[model samples]
Each structure stands twice: as structure tokens, then as C-alpha cells.
Target: MIDLQTKLVGLIGKPLEHSLSPWMHNETYTRLGLNMAYLPIEVLENDLETVINGIRKMNFIGFNVTIPHKISIIPYLDDIDPLAKQIGSVNTITCCNGFLKGYNTDGEGFVSYLETSQGINCSDKVFLIMGSGGASRAIAMTLAARKAKKIYLFNRTIEKAKQLASEIMSYYDCICQAKNLDDTTLKALIKKADVLINTTSVGLYPNIDQTPVKYDLLSSHLIVADIIYNPLHTRLLQEAKEKGCGIVTGEGMFVNQGAKAFAIWTKQPAPYSMMKRVLEEKLI
Candidate 1:
């Protein structure tokens, strides 16, 4: 029953072909009897500003940001949440009275997934995060804020990882280190890590065969997590399982994040169970 009164929400990013956000959000809306709809809008980097300007003039409640646009979209928004500003990325945006605000739900969402679903506490754990992108920044900052004992950031570009680590060290009382993606460093750091998270798009859909870390680096004591939910079982998770490592799929973070974003937009508790079921069904 979509009409002029329906509140529209969207996911804005490129290569949204594999996104499960629309299904998850719309199912929750249907179950809750909300007059809302979620759509996926594929927009390239060059057209982000133009698309955002168009959204402002429409009846949109809010939208989710992803991938290449997360960091770049900051300037276009009217305001930014403190956490998102600090993390240097924006994954969620809200619109009210024609004013758009940005937020980074990725970190909080991932932490919620780890704490609630996996029973992992950040206070005493050592984390090895791969990548320095939007998702990576959010997760690292969140973990640091949670009093994680140590965080090691690894990325293709050492400087980016170093910058993130420096920020975490300056703001939080945590041991943060940054390193270039090398076999020697990975071998050493992974031995000391309790959790290894992949925030990179290496194992995303269409390139499902690629992985960020070598299979041999995984161990029984490590909990490997990936943020790429499209494939459900990425090659990194697959190999981690084979090596007797505990694997946390991207679905938990995806659902938890969507739940948070839903609450932000609707000003009500999200239907987590329904959203999780819908996302799991789509992935299956």
C-alpha cells in the first residue's frame, strides 16, 4: 500500500546488486505494519552529491551508506554524530525537516554482534583488524572505546592503518598498532590476537574466492569475523573453520546494524528476530 504518505528509506552505494538490506528492512516494516519502504539506489562516486541533494527534496526518512561513499559522503551532510565524526566515516544518515545527519553504526553494530551473539567481551581481548576503510575505522574505534586490551590494524597502505591506530591511541587507553600487510607481521600479530576481523571487501560477492589472510595463519584460539555478508561463508571464514577457528559470519553484524539504524529512523525498538530471520532466509 505504498502511497504519498509512505516514508521512504534507501541504501545508497555502488554495486548494490548483492545487498540484503532492502529485504531485511522491508520485512521488518511489513511485520510491524509500518508504512515504510526501503529501496536500493546504485550511485557512483561522481553522482553522490547530486543524488543526496535529490533525496533531501523528497519524502525520505533516512538512508544507509556503504562502501566507497561512506567517508566521501561526510561533507554533503548537514551534521554528523560525534562518533561518526571521530571515526572519520558515515554509514547511516537521517533526515529531519530537510536536514541530513550522518552516523557510523558499523562499530556499535559489530560490537553488539560480538558481545550478544558470540559472548566476546572487548575489555580484555586483543583484536587484529584487516583494512582501514569506513567499517574498519568504526570497529576499531568502538573496540578501543570498549577498553579492548590491544588493537592491531593491518592494511595494504601502512600510512592509513597508522593514522587510524594513532587516533585510537590518542583518544582511548588502549594499545594500538599499525602495520603493513605482510606475512611476517600477520604471522606474529595473529598469534597474539583473540579476534581477527575482515572489514575489507576482499571476500565480497562476485569475488567470493579471494581472502585477506592466508589460511595457515588461522588457529584454534582465534575468532575470525568478516563484514561481507553477501556470501555468508566467505573464503576467510571457510578456511578459519577448517583450521578449527571460531567463525563469526557477517550476518550478525548486518542484522544488528540494521536494527540500530531502524531504531534511529522509527524511534522504536527494532524487530530484531524478524529481521534476522528475513536476512538468513535471503542468504540461504
Candidate 2:
């Protein structure tokens, strides 16, 4: 049990009913005997400013930003972390000296998980990213910073994908290109990709049938990753596994990112083992 006077923290996003952040953070806080509570604040687009301003006046210590608010919350922040600025998104926010500072723990979380769990150094790998949204930007920027040999982005909208590629190229020396996910182009790209990542909402809940790439295009040499953890193993990951490709689930990303946010909020090393145990228990 934690001290009753512990601080409050939480996640802010629309439709946060499915979030596991509260469970993970509160469990850690209890395990450490810290006085903190994590909650979920579901806010729509119009309520964004109101919610942020309210956080300032509340007893909240910090909050994790998610989904639609990741990029939209940037303008409301007092300051942004350089990495978050570069990635053009913020997933972690902390109150420091009466100011809210935004940070992008997603990139660091992805890189850390890759190194620690998969032993896969992204530096020399060719990355084919699917999506042009906030998650894709963070993942693409991290891959470029890690010295990925080449990074290709495929999105339904060619212009959006190109825009993301342009932004990433400004800071890192990498061959970044964008492609439209036509049947022909997608098949060709998947055949050549060493690491294929789905950063889009494809294969997520309510749209589990939709996958960014065709399964027939995948090969054993590919390392397939989908950032959809709700179903544990997305159809994309399951199909890739059937093809003998290495698979990485979104749970790894969720745990790592949450751990980073927990560390930032408490200024203490995250209780990763305890956190993971809590997550597993909730999942079961």
C-alpha cells in the first residue's frame, strides 16, 4: 500500500477506457510504497486546452499524453523536450518548477526494447515503416538517429508520407523516402524490407481485418513489428509468424514507454519487474 498523501498522475487521451497506463503506474507506486495515484482523463479535441490548464491547478504531479493529443498538446505546453520537438510529438509530460515540460519517451522506449530484448541493432538495418502519423515520426526519427541504413515510409497518402520523410531528413543523415501503398509498390517494398513496422492504427481493435501490407509479401528474413497491443498478437504479427518472420508485439513498446514515463514522474528508476508483473496480471 502507498501513502495516502502521495501525488497524482495519469494519462490524457480521448476514449481512454482501454488504457493500461493507470494499472501499470499505480501498481508500481504501490509496490514502492510511494504516495501516488495514476488516473485516466479522457478529453476530446475541444477540451484539450481546458484539460491541460486544469492539470496546472490540480494536485496532479504529471501525465502521459496519448493518441490524438500527442501532437495537438504541443502548442499548449510550456516547453518541449528536444527529442519530442524533433519527433513532433509528446507522450510524457511533467510539472517542473511550475511549468509543464513535454518529452517523447516513445523513441527511447522503442530503441531500448530493441537492444535489450531483441539484441537487434537498428543502426545497419533497412526499415520500412507503415504510417505517417505521430508514432511513425517518432519511430522513423529514432531509426535515423540510430543510423538505420535506409528508411522508407509507406502511407495511404503519398503527400503525408513525403512530408514526414522531409521532416526527418532535416536532422539526420539518412536515405528517407516515401511511397504510396499500392499493391505493386507495397509488395515490392515488403520483399526488400529487413524490418517492417506498422505504425498506423491498422490491425487495431475494431479493424482487426485491415493490415497495411499483404501477408504473401512477407518473408522469413523480415522482422515484423506492429504497435497494436490490445489483441496481444495482431493478425499482422500472426501472419508474419506463420511465414517464419521474427515478430515484435506492441506490449513491449507499451511497457517500455510506460516505464520511461514512470521514471520521469518519480525521478527514480522504474520498477520494471514489478511493473511488468502488474501488466501481466491485468492482461490475464
Candidate 3:
């Protein structure tokens, strides 16, 4: 346990006190008898470059990116996965031969969770995604790639939403619409959406009382999802469940994404079930 040969992997971003990634990954490593340890490092915006440089010289297998750092970390990477490049976000990174390559597992993770756990396919679903950040870019692009019928993006800044929608429409055969967070527009779009996802940090830990969408808007037919797992059931998911809507929490995505990153780092199939169990045990 105190050996110097233990390899390291971790998550790098600000406000990491709420992250369960270390628990999920470390448990998987323990069960598999892998000499690996996971850590969480909170890096400020200005110190991101310094931290990345330090990680490059250290004994790091790789690390996961989150929140504000996902997009910003791209410039520091040696290479990027084609899909992650297209999505303009990087959530996972693998270091090999002193070279750091970035990849975005968020979209694939969300898609996997949606199909297996929620029993929903992207092809026939119309999605309304809240927030236009890195996570939004990854999820929207992935859904469009899967041939989602239509996608609506709502964000505080209309331009970012439009930019992401335009990027999706340019590369994928999907009808992607973007708009400002207007009540009337949200109401009309929610009525047509089959799945509603919250990719914002509004309902994350410490700010547990905040929510991105109005509670009254959730309908019984919609499958509502939030990507904030710390609370398990966020205000959005709680309201959606109370309104009789189907619900998907952030845990599925978190576990799925971490599993993918694990495989990338170890060159072995990740123990997905065990990873999921670890996160659920802590979160649920």
C-alpha cells in the first residue's frame, strides 16, 4: 500500500470537495488488485497550466477534467481524440511516453446510460439540454451523432447555445436549435422534448438549493436527467420525479465516463459494474 510503484490517476478542477470519482476508481482498483491510486486536485483557473506541467513530469497515468477546465485544458494537450476534438471538450486524458492525449467521454457515457439504464435510444428522441458549457457540447454532439430527431439548447448566453447548435448541424444530420432562456420558449420546447437534461453546475453540491429549470415545467412523459451526482437527486430530478416524470441522475454518467477513462489508462476493460456500485454506495 505504501509502495513507490503505485500509479496515479485523478480529477483536476476547482471545487472538487464534492467529487466521488476517487471513491469509484479506487474501489475498482482495489477489487482488481491494481497498484493504482486516485486523487482529487482542486486547481484554480490561473494555476491550470502550472498543474498540467507538473503532472506531465510526475508519475501520472492520466486524469479526468471537469467543469471549467474541460475546455481550457485542450491547449495544453499533445493530442485529442477526433470525437473530443469535434465536441470541443476534453473530460479524460491519457499520458503515454510523456505525451498527454485528451478525450471526451461525457457524450459516450451519457449515451450509454440513456440506452441501458433509461431504455431510451437517441434516434427517436427530441432533447432539450440546459446549459451550453463543455458538458453540453459533448452531450449534444453525441446525441446528434446518434441521430436524435431534434435538439434544443437553452443557455443564459444565447450566442454560445447557437454556436454549439451550429457546430452540431454542420457535422451531423440533426435539427439543432438554440435559444436564450426565455420562459415562453422553454415552455414550448419542453412540450416537444422527449428527454430533458441539465448539464449546468447550478444544482451541484454547496449550491444544492439551486436549479436550472422551473419545477412546473416537468411533464409525466418526459425523461428528465441531471448531471449533478453528489446529491443523487437534485432539485431538478426531485421535482421531475414528483411530477411523475422518468428520471436519470448523474451517477450513471459519472460511472460510465470514469470506466471509459479507466480502460484508456490501463489498456484493460474497466470493471463497470463494480465502479457503478462504488458510486451508488456513496451517493445513494
Best by lDDT: 1
Better of 2 and 3 by TM-score: 2
On residues 1-284, what C-alpha lDDT tens digit does candidate 2 reach at each position?
33556587889998888898888888777777787888898889999998888889877778999988999999999999888999999999997655899999887887677667777888778889989888888889988888888999998888989998998889989989999888788788777778888888988888888777787888899888888787778899999999999989887888999999888988888888788888889876
**On a 0 to 100 scale, what is the lDDT of residue 249 in model 2?**
85
Candidate 2 regions with alpha-carbon error over 4 angstroms: 1-4
Clashing pairs in 3: none
lDDT of 3 by residue, 1-284 (tens): 83789898999998887677888888889888999999899999999999999999888989999877998999999999999999998999998756999999999998889889887778999999999988889999999989999999999998999999999999999999997898888988899999999998898887898889888777899999998887889999999999999999988898899999999999999898899887778865
The C-alpha stretches of model 3 lying farther than 4 A from their native spots are none
Q: Estimate each model's TM-score.
A: 0.95, 0.95, 0.93
What is the lDDT of every predicted structure here? 0.91, 0.86, 0.90
Q: Estimate the Cα RMSD of every predicted model relative to the unseen true structure.
A: 1.5, 1.6, 1.7
What tens-digit string does per-residue lDDT give for candidate 1 at 1-284?
A: 89999999999998897778988898878888999999999999999989999999999999999877998999999999998988999988999978999988889999888887778788989999999987899999999989999999999988999999999998888999998899998999998999999999998978998999988778889999998887989999999999998889988898989999999998888888888998888778
lDDT of 3 at 259: 93
